[model samples]
Target: MNVILRRLGMALLILFLAGPAYAQIDTAAREAYLVDATTGTVLLDKDGERAMPPASMSKIMTVYAVLDRIRQGRLSLEYTLPVSERAWRMGGSKMFVEIGDDIRVEDLLRGVIVQSGNDACVVLAEGLSGSEEAFANELNRLADDIGLRDSAFRNATGWPAEGHVMSARDLAHLAHRLITDFPDHYHYYSELEFTWNDIRQSNRNPLLYRNVGADGLKTGHTEEAGYGLTASAVQNDRRLILVVTGLESQRQRAEEAERLMRWGFREFENFELFEAGAMIEEADVWLGASSTVPLVAQNDVLVTMRHAAREEMTAKVVYDGPIAAPLQAGQQIATLRIEGPGIAGHEVPLVAGVDVPPAGYFQRIYQKARYLLLERQ
Candidate 1:
């Protein structure tokens, strides 16, 4: 049985006993979420987990589904898809694709991403799964594999339909995945405009045109869903993904996206708390040659939090002890959990710094008897 202990070891270093205080932001969006992409720290969450209509913002998933197929060698950027009557009849946004025309895959991606073309989505869906409805089933399967728990996709176009929904957190996660998983295709989100068939349409994402480091993602709008945007940006190699939905207008969407992006980047920063192989403390061992085993980290432990919370955060060493003997060096023996205001929760693994072989047989027996006798006392 593992004994639970909350006591800090002799190596307690950081001062962190005060009450916790996380950062907060005022947002006009009905749903908003901001996170540090590199560290997976959630900086802001306001109705972020609640499922709602994502409007065209759902196109990001459609695009993701296509990109994944490309990665699996089932599709290629050079592949062409035929525009069907269903696609040509699609309403809302338009890629101006003509029926019976075979459009290149690259062009279709641009049409869907840059123009938010419902029709382009249908073409890609039809080409991939023989129909948009079938492709939507494939999308749900792919979404499950990608770990989207609260999203349900009913159409490739993100058109108004029952049971079509996504949480802000899910959307932000999708944005982060696109940036990290598809470096080659991610550049498409940054394109300012695309021209096809004598028509030019600018990308709908407002962040791309601004001075901020924002790059890729999509925007969604419907009378029921309002305006929403899934945006990601990098400042100094640290990326932050922001998802906002239910804004009043296009201008509000632009303003809220920029404001949240600025707030997230400016308020949060990454700090390394411990280096790899650094000794943190010593944990007691049971019936071992040595009474204590040095505890150390196996990797760098870095945390992202508000700048003000660095001094307030407390680090605690938690482990079951006295740890049993016969342990090899580098065996994980404890967790270094951190908590405080403006800080995201983190639990860094602390491993044994040295071998802990069992004590001699007689010594083990003697220790056991002594422990039993002491228990009686």
Candidate 2:
């Protein structure tokens, strides 16, 4: 009877401890995910890993590849390329690149982004790779290099193709990588409007104006692909990447993206686990010159969670203790894991805060004796 009572009491205590940690995540999209750009931690996801048509969001890779070429000095934004008839005939969303007209690479980028111009994409692809097919091969190669396993590119313009597809998680990964890896050229993704041949068009990504902190990204729509968006925003020095795919309408895509962004920014707080090289705690030593050695973090540790449950968080550090001396600085020594309500726990590797050289011969013998004695403690 006493054992039963104790078990029931522990169950009640666990529920009481966890009750306040739950927050309703109101994200509405067929395929969606949110990730911390700095930490690469997935905060929310629904069918995010499943492959789906990215529609025009595929252009994100197209632009990324082009920017890479420009950075390598193989291409220049000021370079001019003649518009071909094939580029002019591109079916959907055009910057009116007419045959025989020459346009600068810089202006073509604005056209592709602001107007969702298939024509502009073709011109850029042909200009950079000498052909659209070659440019797409480059896109796929780069995607593999960047860890986008489920993404494949068939064309530069993101026009519907049989095998051209990407998962929501992969899209977010690509967007986050672009911003973090190439900040110098990332500003171009935020351009709101562009003019070509005296006609102006606005970018389709609605979150740029509707959501605070929303900076830049891309949007796409096709009868078969539906409406999709890959958006990102920064708040309190933390940047978040969001991907939403296959919405029924443009209005729904905008509304849902804003809602998801708001839910993430307003509800969650990011916690720093440890500062880079900051000592976590000291490990006990036996017969060494120093009685204790410091355990540190190799990198900044961070996690995101619901703001109200911050007090409930707990951290546990695990490592092989009484480490043999001659430990080098920056060597991985342990792991720090954090757990709290409503958040899945995450681990960050801990490292030796400083070098610890072995003791002299006499000291080594003494340490062995100490270990034998301490085993009883």
TM-score of each: 0.88, 0.89
Tens digit of lDDT per residue, candidate 2, span 220-295?
8887778999999998898889998888999999999998888888877676766887876666554456656777
Which portions of model 2 show Cα errors greater than 4 Å?
1-27, 284-288, 311-313, 340-345
- State, as a TM-score between 0 and 1, how close model 2 is to the true structure: 0.89
lDDT tens readout by residue for model 1, 208-304: 9877798888999999999999999999888999999999999999998999999888877887777889877678788999878888898887778
Q: Candidate 1, which segments miss by more than 4 Å at Cα?
A: 1-20, 287-292, 343-345, 353-377
- The CA lDDT of each predicted structure is 0.87, 0.79
Root-mean-square deviation of every model: 3.8, 5.7
The model with the greatest TM-score is 2
Model 2: lowest-lDDT 10 consecutive positions: 8-17
Clashing pairs in 1: 21-341, 21-342, 22-342
TM-score of model 1 (CA atoms):
0.88
Worst 10 residues of 1 by lDDT: 1-10
The true-structure Cα RMSD of candidate 2 reads 5.7
